[model samples]
Target: MDVISAVGAAIRTAFDMFWDVLWPLVLGFGLSGIVQALVSHKTMAKLLGDDSPRSLSLATLFGVASSSCSYAAVALARSIFRKGASFVSAMVFEIASTNLVIELGVILIVLLGWQFAASEFLGGIVMVILLALIFRVTLTPRLVSLAREHAERDAVGRMEGHATMDMSVQGGSFLSRLLSGRGFTSISHLFVMDWASVWVDVAGGFLIAGALAAWVPESFWQHLFLSGNPTLAKIEGPLVGPLVAIISFVCSVGNVPLAAVLWRGGISFGGVVSFIFADLIVLPVLDIYRRYYGGRVMLYIFATFYVTMAAAGYIVEIVFGALGIIPSNRAVGIITHGPSWNYTSILNIVALVVAAILLVRFLRTGGPAMLRMMSKPETSGEHDHQAIAMDRSIP
Candidate 1:
């Protein structure tokens, strides 16, 4: 009976956290869908063909405008790489898509604070710059060749279909295309597809966070984070942050809830930031990298990513500490709150209505079939053409 009660409490906490962020998630995804519906992957590929400053900048911008699903981001990065994007640029895009997205920032603001959200974006840029330098120095022509050769093979990874599907509406002014039937269908399709790609991770993150918040003693977290010694904690937080995240098996925006738990449990601000950035290096994503780029390149990526993620955490911690903006109060309300008549509830209601509308559009316009193909690997541009044809047929 005690265990059952505990489980229920954990689930309730998870639901509360989900409820708190529901509106931000919906708004972020809606905006992302609109961007995806307008931007062509072909244009992104063309712009990112080289590793110049321009290409890398464009990659970051494009990544911020894309889906925040870690799996989809990884798959799409590979697709762009195979389609003529420079290796460094592709990696930057992957990092930006997962770490610097709008949904992620909004969720952080809601759960942790605006400081955390700011740290995430700032640290993301630092990580990207660090990674680009590292790659420029260490990425060899032979390694690139090996990765390309492996990627060219018919190996499968999660969200391959999503990465390849291009539903961008074309052949009109921006406003005209956006107001067209094809535009609505395109946005709905991309929105649903993005949700499908990351729902499991998101759910898992909330559950784990809730469980940790409910069952784990504050003493345990304090000891694990070395909270007794401020100096040591600062040094260790950034270093160990990514290691914890690598084992968490949670990625994308899903990790934000867990991050809030960690912060409340006495983790340093830098630790929370680094943990969020390390989503790309989670065990499952590491395996995907191994499958997509062979073991050698995978190992190389893991090494570079770890160093940069940790470094970025350390830098952000120092910079933010100097600015005196790190929120001293670590209390997150969602962990203890239940359903109530409040602003959160009001926003969640509105969000659900928006979600329902998009979902209805998705169901009415052949979204189920598209979802079935989300995991299937793409072999050519045939899928994009077919998707565009289907969009034209809508309405």
Candidate 2:
């Protein structure tokens, strides 16, 4: 009976997460697709020029306007990095796309309340600034050379094509087209691509949340990292939560529900925030980074991001506490009853259909095929041996 009840509860939680996040994700994805269509790669390259002080800001805006998938972000960052974006700026883009996007902000506002939502944006900016400052102080020529060599190898010694808007005008002036450039077909395609990008994360997060709701023993979490002090307890959450996130292998916004579960399980506020922030350091991305930059570069990236997240999480907890905004309980239940035939269920079905149509459109359009053509194995130059050495060292 207890087991059956748990299973039922999990299903309800998953359904509720799906219901709350699906529409906002669709809107976010569309906005990203339109932005991608409009922004030229040359423009991005110029904005991210080595000497541009505004490079980080431009990177942040581009990231918020681009796709939210961590894997996709990695590919896009690599593409821009090849075109002269600084490593720091590219990292900032990755962070922004993951944390500061429209869908994420909307979901946070809806699920966790406006304060947590605001903290996410504030925390993202802080993370970006820290990354830029870290780069200024710790960047080594060897690291830069390695990244460039790997990027060139990945491109097979050629630059990848930029994402450009496909506007067909019948001999009209630039301004004439700019004001009314898109037809019905273009608008539909934009919505389709946007929905597809966000749908995967939403569904994945639901599935994971369901599993956690059903199977994770609640008692185990209450004692994992008790140090008898709130600040110390909070500080420790970031460290352990990220380790768990890395091992879980679900990147992007898919990690949110799990973070919520941790918050419910007595993990500190800073810890939950850190777990959410540490998505970039997860296994799939780390493996790709290793493939792209060899072990040394990967290690540096891991250390840099991990330390920065720890600090950010602690700072957020302190700020929120001082401001008297820290919630007494992080897990305010969203779904009280089991799934049934209702408005939310109807909407869930609709979201599923919408997701499927968008997915089909995305594959049929140029995006998926283009990404496939672009994903080539990079050679690790001098770091090839270092990669091997590092793997052995990872006990």
Q: Rate the local accuracy (lDDT) of all candidates.
A: 0.88, 0.65
lDDT of 1 at 27: 86
List of clashing residue pairs for candidate 1? none
Give model 2's TM-score versus the native structure. Answer: 0.79
List model 2 lDDT by residue over 1-395, tens digit each: 48788778777778776666565566555555555545444467668866245888889998887666676677667767877888777778888878887767766665667776777887888888887888888989889889878766663221112122221222355444334423222333445544444456557767777777667766677677553567668768878877878887777777876666677777887787888888798886887788667778889999999988877777888899899998886564664434456664666577678666655544444434333333233332211211222122211
Give residue 24's error in model 1 in angstroms: 1.0
Model 2: lDDT of residue 139: 82
Clashing pairs in 2: 29-194, 30-194
lDDT of 1: 0.88
Off by over 4 Å in 1: 385-395
In model 2, which range of ten residues has the least summed lDDT?
381-390
**Tens digit of lDDT per residue, candidate 1, span 1-395?**
39999999889899989888988889888888998888888788899999999999999998988889888889999998988998899999999999888889889998888999999999999998999999999999999999999988867888888887888888889999888888888888888888888899999999999999989988998999999998888889988889999999999999999999999888888899899999999999999999999999999999999999889999999999999998888789878665678888898899889889889888887788888778888774436633544554457
